[model samples]
Target: MMTLSAPLLALLWLVQVVCSAFPEEPGPLSSIPTEVRKYPVFLGRPHRSSLRQEPLHIQRILQVNRTLYIGADDLFRVELDNVVGDEMFYSKKRTWESNKNDISICRMKGKHEGDTLEMVGETVSGMARCPYDPKHANVALFAGNLFTATVTDFLAIDAVIYRSLGDSPALRTIKHDSKWFRYQLNKMVVDTNAGPHGNRTVLFLGSSRGTILKFLVVPNQDNTAPNNNVFLEELEGYNPECGQDTPQARQLLSLTLDSNSHTLLLAFPSCVVRIPVARCQLYSRCMNCISSRDPYCGWTRGSTCSFLRAGTLPFEQDVDHGNTSYLGDCDLLQESYIEEPDGLVSVNLLVLSAVSAFSTGAALSGLMVCWIMTVKHRQRSRGGGSGPGGRRKCEKEQNMLG
Candidate 1:
């Protein structure tokens, strides 16, 4: 018999913990054969998310040219790129030589006349921006910056390939059921891909609790409308701690995706880790793939279910490319088939949880009963023996004297 690797053992342990307490059975999602399932590939082998020597003390993190920069009180670069140029989204046209800044900007000429002009993505440096204090009693800035403040007068907003900062809705973390969404909103990432919708955009919100939520952002029916209609009905969520009933607010300082290696870097409160996005391949069976409500994922004709836009490197698309489901004229997914709301995994977890609760409750009840019996026996032994109840002042005094 061969001994298991430390990492594999650790992963198995984590699975037991997370899977056993799953909120509900993953329904059919978890019912597929293990062979057909795209089990996660452990890129860093026994890849743990929070194992850093120093405490994760940053507020935000950004990936530029394969370098991960963190922001909290200050911005600092982490220079641990095993494969250089793996995490950045854009190509560097020129070498940067600057003072006081390590992350350099590679300028691209504007293609359209109406496009917002600036050094990088439209915002110019050193322009006097009206800094209005939101906490101020009554002062604000809205109309002067724009040609007009009227809702009808449309203002063209400059955006990029990333949906996180593009024309999307306000980030809402609450669930539809009114249960408080447990994760603390830390950072957001937009995954651009071709979808059935048109230009597909799925937003990934990282929380302080180490959970990453997959959200769908659909614009209003009117083309010119601009207000976040965030549909918190998520397809899947990843919590690094796995199966923790109430996960602590362990902030993910930043998230970086390595396109070349198909890896993802997550900076947590305790440590930083690299996980393979290739392993996150959600669908395998074509039917299941089509059934998954994940917007950035799709089932190819070849029976391969992966990211909808995986093959397109240096992926070029108008900022609004949609999901593959649009192309799938497949049947609508049944309520039991969806993975987001509930899964068969949750049922297993619930059963284990119920048993655990009952066991604990019974143990506590037995202890309470024993304590009560002991107190009753002691009272009978005392039998009005002036134990401060005061049968009579003289009798109480006699018992106290005895």
Candidate 2:
């Protein structure tokens, strides 16, 4: 038997009450198998230059091949190299450094012929930039394009690797409107390997309301011009304990995707949650699954809607065009209620048929009435006779008794 002191038991009871007030959320669904690596390796931090006085906070990290790019107030490039049997090695290089004051000199260094010198100069510093904000925006480097989104704007820069900042023009810029868009976008993740052909760039945007907006951006397609940026669907990632019209906003702190697990990691202020990108279990039947139009889901064996696993064969999925007729037996959807007795089914079918017939008859009667009224209106307009009773009271003197 275990015994606790009075103060210890009081502490335990308080812990239990606090835990009950904030219970853990349900774990996300995961069907894919993942390999686990328990060994750990730590890399040495990069040495900072003496010129950098402030402490650094890494805002974003991106890896391309063996090179890792770290963005902070400044930018760094880390080269990770490991030869055949040697210990892993890496080198860090500071690619760009921010200045407290940016001094711009135009024609400052020019050749002087016969003692005349001209210079034009401008300098600015410490202007607030959204990209420099710690966690209020996101920057994505995908397929030679640089996409950046802040709370109030979105911009796409094309072929950023080839063009210098002085010459690279913005490909697209859209200012956010809260009145119409209804949410403040602060976090975004770009998935390049998406869609049926696996060549689309799909963006998952996270808003202050704990909602995610999924959309596709087709840049310079070969055949036709690209379409407008229309969101495919709005998924509720987290529901805040607040009204829709509340003035206070709950911003998403972090949003990232795990490609191996096919899940999204969403971090809010109060809690963290994992959401599977595709919820195939919501669809029960073949037609229903096919109509969902989710690329990550497919109708597989056992007549079940399931996540599309690698190397799985004979699955039915059509994300581009959700054609229910692809199964050739979608008529089963109409007769899915097979558990009912034959008499009950027949009676239900008769009632359904009667209701459908009555609806059609009522629609036709409405159209006929509208047509007759239109004709009477035209006749009255042409005759043009009016008194207390419009249309001349059908000629009162025509009654013989009168």
Model 1 Cα displacement at 100 (Å)? 25
Clashing residue pairs in all predictions, respectively, total: 30, 0
Give a tens-digit lDDT track for model 1, residues 33-148.
12211222111111234332233344555766757555533344554444332222212212235553433332333366667666656753211222222211222234323211
Q: In lDDT terms, how accurate is model 1?
A: 0.44
C-alpha positional error of residue 113 in candidate 2 after TM-score superposition, expressed in Å: 56
Q: Which tens-of-lDDT digit does each residue in 1-402 have in candidate 2?
A: 988899999999999999899845332122212110111111223432323223333454555655545455456555534312211122655546445454333345455785776566765331222333443444454445444443332222111212112336644444334465456777889877764346556688888766777664546545566454435556776533221323222345578775655656554433333566666665767787777666667777656677776666678886656687646875353323323455564444677899999999999999999999999999888666655564346766466456
Q: What would the TM-score be for candidate 2 when compared with the true structure?
A: 0.39
Return the TM-score for candidate 1, rounded to 2 decimals: 0.34
Q: What are the lDDT figures for the candidates, one per model?
A: 0.44, 0.53
Candidate 2 overall Cα lDDT vs. reference? 0.53
Candidate 2: list runs displaced more than 4 Å.
1-177, 195-201, 216-220, 223-230, 239-249, 331-402
